[model samples]
Target: MEMQVWASLFGVILGGLLSYLAQFTTVRLAARNEEKRQAAQRAEARRSERLELLREFIAITQAGIRIAEERDQAPDWDAAGTPEWFAAARNIIDRLWVAERMIEVLFSPQMYQLARAYASAVDHVLWRLPEQIAAEGSMWDHLRGPQHEFLAGARTDVGSLP
Candidate 1:
């Protein structure tokens, strides 16, 4: 073959290889970026779910105290009629039940675990409050006591959302 023809063939082959490699690298990088973006979106969704659970848990605990106070022996203004705490508890539970369904929509096992922990803490507070009331003991103090470290459980793995 002529030298010029050989040179032309070599140049064309090299250009083709370079083009293919460039496209391959670009596609790979784009795929990687897409994956990272998806992961970040999933993480944000989970954090949102976790924060919702925390809000409900806190609301329930705070409101349960108020509901009980409505039936208190003393009528401190803080103990006035219409137990806000009781209402708060019921409201939080109602909101949380919906949040639980939302967690399924977002579908992250880790987030679900955090949410479940919050639910458990709130449930414990709700369940134990009546007993503490019957015993004429402070429920807040009861929470601080060795009630299987309920407070600690409440503190575990809570994710905050901005």
Candidate 2:
């Protein structure tokens, strides 16, 4: 009778140990899974931010291209600087300023450089349109090569990232 009582007590103790170990393992696994979930969420947020920034960059760059192409229409930039020209330039400059600020915060150095190249191409058009057109008869024709190059480089940069 005493042996039977001892066996039952041992069995109870073993069952309790087993229960404790199972709970401990389950808690650790749950914590690990939570950490993974949080990390994945952070990564996704950063990716969305990068995509949004790139989209804004593309928008501003395309607007600048359109402006450059439009300037190609006027006989001279002196003649082109009408109210409409100033208004369009103002709008584009404002948006470009915002994009540049975002780039400074979010982009890698190479990405920023690509953006700067595109912006500089636009500035070149804005500053030298009259002279370029006066000399070459079609300003955009000359600028198009560099503009395309900058834009393509930027696109490649964006595509290469995961």
What is the C-alpha local distance difference test score of candidate 1?
Answer: 0.58
**TM-score (all chains, Cα) for each model:** 0.60, 0.78
Give the residue spans of candidate 2 off by over 4 A.
132-162
The segments of candidate 1 whose C-alpha lies over 4 angstroms from its true place after superposition are 74-136, 146-156, 159-162
Best by lDDT: 2
Cα misplacement distance, residue 122 of candidate 2 (Å): 1.6
lDDT of 1 by residue, 1-162 (tens): 699999999999999999999999999999999999999998888777666665654565455544544444445534443466556656766765566556545535655555555455444555453455568465455444432343444345442332
